[model samples]
Target chain A: MYSYSDFDEAFVRSRVAQFTDQVARRLDGSLSEDEFRPLRLMNGLYLQLHAYMLRVAIPYGTLSPRQMRQLAFIADTWDKGYGHFTTRQNIQFNWPKLPDAPAILGALADVEMHAIQTSGNTVRNVTADHFAGATADEIDDPRPYAELLRQWSTDHPEFQFLPRKFKIAITGSPVTAP
Target chain B: MTKAHDIGLRMVRNAGGEPGFEVIVGGGLGRTPMIGTTVRDFLPVADLLPYVEAVLSVYNTLGRRDNKYKARIKITVHETGKAEISRMIEDRFAELRPLFGGGDQAVLADIRTAFAPPAFRDAPVAAHDAFYRADPVFRSWADTNLAAHRNAQYAIVTISLKAHGQTPGDATSDQMRIIADLAERYGHSDLRISHEQNVILPHVHKSDLPVLHAALVKAGLGTANVGLLSDIIACPGMDYCALATARSIPVAQELATHFEALKLEHDIGPLKIKISGCINACGHHHVGHIGILGLDRAGVENYQITLGGDGTETAVIGEKTGPGFAYDEIVPAIERILRAYLALRTDPGETFLQAYRRVGLGPFKTALYGEIGQKDAA
Candidate 1:
């Protein structure tokens, strides 16, 4: 699994802080629903049917045991007891409170995880075959490149405001590559 | 290769040893489902980036901006046709090719070196066989969850997230931890999340199967229903998704529970029942053997069934059955179709898809609407 460097950690921390301020502003009536909607979406927060849903990106669907444990903690402590893993290999906390979004982002930042780019029109999470490194028939692991792409696309200026969401999926195995 | 248009690009490897890709374009799924057309049948591996850049540029210029629904590359491809799209991509590629030169190959080489596969150890098969014989449940799970690995001693284990009566792709925090632990200890620290919403331990020694299965069982993740009806793929429908017109999870849960109670899934053979909350096809309902699309008809939730959709190498979009069913009528409707399949199939060897293909929709439709038709006639 890829671990966050000092730069990566600092980037996420700063973003989390920014989001925390934005969230506070929204609560304080400084930002309306329309203004806060895109901001919150870029942070992977959605005001769904019943409650706020927080989608956390699991890049290339790879997770360390420690990271998985942290997610479990987040699920147990903040949201419901379980999380819904989406088709994109991301996990969604269906019942998150509006106020807890910052806290959840902070918890994720501790584990080198974030909800950034999980939603929005920008290049979303770079997905790879869940069997990337482990599969026998694959030409290569594909995750390293997926990670590279993730870093390159995270906040790429040129693609930040594309008309639609861009999804990139990579797979080494010909049999499983969709 | 066919559905490339939907996602903008598809790379099919060239047959020769020299690494290359045959890029397909314009495949996508949604209200206007389309399979991608082959734009470049034999693009060299080195030209991947510049070529892709060309395609995206073409799409950026030509793709629809007026209607949000029609903005995908597929629609552009549909309007312009494959010939013009190909010509535009080739022209762009020609212009951009010189900028790349040969730098991308070195980068690719470095990436390949970093992605080398892990060393695997041979394990005795006797241990696995012994465990399989000792525990019937383990045997059942092994039969379904395990896939043949390149190494004789290794097996690819699919830890199903779709347990009976549960959300199709949901895992409890405890289950996730157990899977992580198993991947670390038994699976050479390798874990994968399958596109089908299952956790995969891609390199587990056969000798470690027993302990892994036991651990999974303890964590409530031991569902031996891979490829079975219970192993459904359902998107978060009305419960969570704003675009959804109907609920998918409850329907899946009910069907899974009903099948489990009957204990008929394993006997029924391989069946893929994918449920999408709407036409967005996030659940891949279009490619499921039995595809269920939830729609809003008036104020009520209506479920539409599509039969014979296959998402394999030979992908086929499922054809819709007649009218949609109400929320409560869906399970019984599914039951009727399954029963019809069971009765109409040539033998047990014939899967749901094979049976459906052979018998067509005639018998199944009759099974579903026969009572209603009779009542109306009376």
Candidate 2:
């Protein structure tokens, strides 16, 4: 599993600070639903049928035991006692409160995980085979390339405002690709 | 090979202990989902990264951005044709190849030198049998849900999500935590997501099956069903998709309710009913044994059913059973089709698909819409 560097850590910390202020503004009527919608969406918060859903990225679906334990904690503490594993190799909390979401995002950042690019019309999470390194027929695990895409796509200036959400799934071979 | 004193790569096996790398691009599900075009039939290990770069650049320059529905790589290949796409990719690939591929054969040799399957202690042959004797649910799940491993001592386990009438492809976050823990403890920390929207632990030793089953059940990720009728793939229809003409999830829920009510899934053998909101085939209705596509009839949501579709090594698009059925009448329509398959089947051994393919979709059409005016035809 990849650990976050100091720069990555600082980036997430600032994001949390920004979102916290944003949430407070929304509550006090400074930010309307229209104003708060894109801000929250950029952070991977979705307003689903039942409640607000938070999609936390599990990059390439790889998690350390400690990170796994933190996910269990989130499920137990904030939302329902479970998380849905998406086809994109990410996880979603179906019933997150609007206010607790920043705290939830904070908890994930503590473990080097975040909800960045999990939603929005921008490039979404870059997915790879869950069994990348351990697979029988891979020429090489595609995660390194997937990671490269994740870095390149994040807040990309030109491709950021495309007409639709962009998704990229990288697999080393055709037979096991999808 | 960066030889580690006790470190090693686990589980890489094919004939002659090697399989060449291949690549596909632009495969996705949505309104226009299609199997990705084969971009690389064989990529030598030395050129892996650069080839992928070339593929992405081609897509970045040429992929559509005007229509949200047509923005996927599949649509790019569809519009330009695979040959043209490949030609452009080749030109880009040539420019990038020399930069990455030159004198990298040693790295290639180093990579292959380290990969191998895990070695496990032989457990008693009767272990699974002993567990089966104690738990019937475990027995049924293991029988249908597990895939045969090339290494006889291990099995690929599937944690089914298709509990009768629940949302498919969904696992609560706690389920994710537990599954990750289970993978580390029992499955060598490797997880897999099956095409059918379920998770897999790829390398479970036979001895650990009993404990793993218990933990899975506790977390509510355990269901004995694998390929039975209840394990459906449904597209998110009018609920979220702007393109859908009808609802797929509710229809899937109803079918699941009907089959589970009858408790006839096992007796009927394996059946897959994939539901799509439109002809784009996101739910993969075209490749299902019994496929349902939600459409519109006079501005009202309706369903178009197809039979004998398959998505295995022998993939085929299904033929339609009839014109279409009203939203309220679709569930009963499917029931009629299943009953017809049961009656027309020559043996219990024949699956619904086998019978449908053998007798053709005409019989199913008659059973489903024999009462409709103008005589519904397959």
Candidate 3:
């Protein structure tokens, strides 16, 4: 797994700080639910059918063991004792509280992961075939390219207001008959 | 990759043997399912960023904004027509290509270094062979959950989250930690989550698989049902998603439990059962060999079945069978179809899709709808 560069670390920390403020404002009744909706969603928070769901991005479906342990920690401490991994290679904590959102983001930052661009009509998680770098059939590791795209698209200013969520997938290997 | 993604890139070596992409644009699944069109037959690796930028730019400028349902790039491609879309993308790519200035390549080069293949150890696999010969349970899990690795000494183990009757993709905190531990100890600290909603230990030494399997079994992560009937793809339907009209998780659980009770999942062979709560297709039901769409028809949970949908390199949309089944009736309906397939297939080797493609939907339709075709003829 690629370790986060200093710039990457700083960027996530800055976003977490910003979101902490946003969440506090929303909880204190200053920002209306309507007002706070997009703010929450921009950070991958969703007010679901029963409770709040926080989706954390696992860029290109790659996770270091340290990161996985952190996710497990978040699942155990904050939300329910489980997490649902989505089709896009992201994980969703189905029962997060609005007040605890920033704290959860902080824990994720400790492991160099975040929920940025995971929701709200932005360029979403850039996914690739799970077998990248490990499969013999691969012509090249697509993770590097997927990582490049993930960096380019994360919090991309222009893409935040797109008509719908945009998705991009890359596969380094040819598909065989399933 | 499934052709249902918004942009699907298949890596291919051109005739001259240089690596590049066969870029397919505008494929999506929701209310509408489309297999993406191949806009560029062969896009050089150097052009990937710029070309993708061009496609996005074209979409941003021209894609429908009036209707939420039609706002996807798939609809944009459909409305614009492929040739015009291709031409527009090409024109945009030509204009945007130079702006990149190869900076992306430098970053990619650096990223590539991080992903270098792990050091595989040459260890004796005598124990692995012995276990394979001795333990039937270990052998079944090994055959079902493991994939051949680039290094012969290594095997890619798919840790099945689809333990019988469990929510398809939910991993308990304890299971997550167990998987993390396995990855760190035996899997070179590499873990992958498949789109099919399973965790993968991508590089486990074959010699270490038995121990890993025992740990996984202890954690209740060992069902040995990867790519089997019980290995379903189900979305968080009405249970979680506000947009859902019906529940998907319970249906998946019931189906898995039903098939497991029959003790027939392994014999049923590689059957994909994808269930979506609504038309959003989050579960990728359209691609399942046995696709089930749960709909709230007049306040009742009605399930619709689609047969022969495939999500491979040769992707095809599934065909819907006759009338929908009630929530309670769906499982039995499915059993009938599978039983019909078992009886109709020429051999056990013939998969559900192969049998469907060869014999067509008539037999399965009759099985599900109870010989309605003959009744209508009569």
- Among these predictions, the greatest TM-score belongs to 3
lDDT of 2 by residue, A44-155 (tens): 9988655787888877666665676788789889977866665456777877898898889889988888998787767777666655554455555655655655655667
DockQ of every predicted complex = 0.47, 0.27, 0.79
Cα lDDT tens digits, model 1, B93-143, are 999889877766565555556455668886478978888898999999989
Q: How does each model score on lDDT?
A: 0.80, 0.71, 0.89
**Predicted candidate 3 versus true structure: per-residue lDDT over A23-113, tens digit per residue:** 8998889999999998988899998899999999999899988888899999989998999998888899999988899999999999999
Query: For model 2, what is the alpha-carbon lDDT of residue B18?
Result: 62
Q: Across residues A1-178, which tens digit of lDDT does each residue of candidate 1 receive?
A: 5667687899999999999999999999999999999999999999888899999998888777777778888989898888888777888899998888899999999989999998887778867777666556766456765676676577867666665666666655656542
Native-to-model Cα distance after best TM-score fit, residue B340 in candidate 1, in Å: 1.8
Ranking by lDDT: 3, 1, 2
Clashing pairs in 3: none
RMSD of candidates 1 onward, in order: 2.9, 6.4, 1.4
Using DockQ as the measure, name the better of candidate 2 and candidate 3: 3
Comparing candidate 1 with candidate 2, which one achieves the higher TM-score? 1
For every model shown, what is its TM-score relative to the native structure? 0.92, 0.79, 0.98
For B39-93, candidate 2 gives per-residue lDDT tens digits of 6665554465566567666767777777766766667777898789889988998
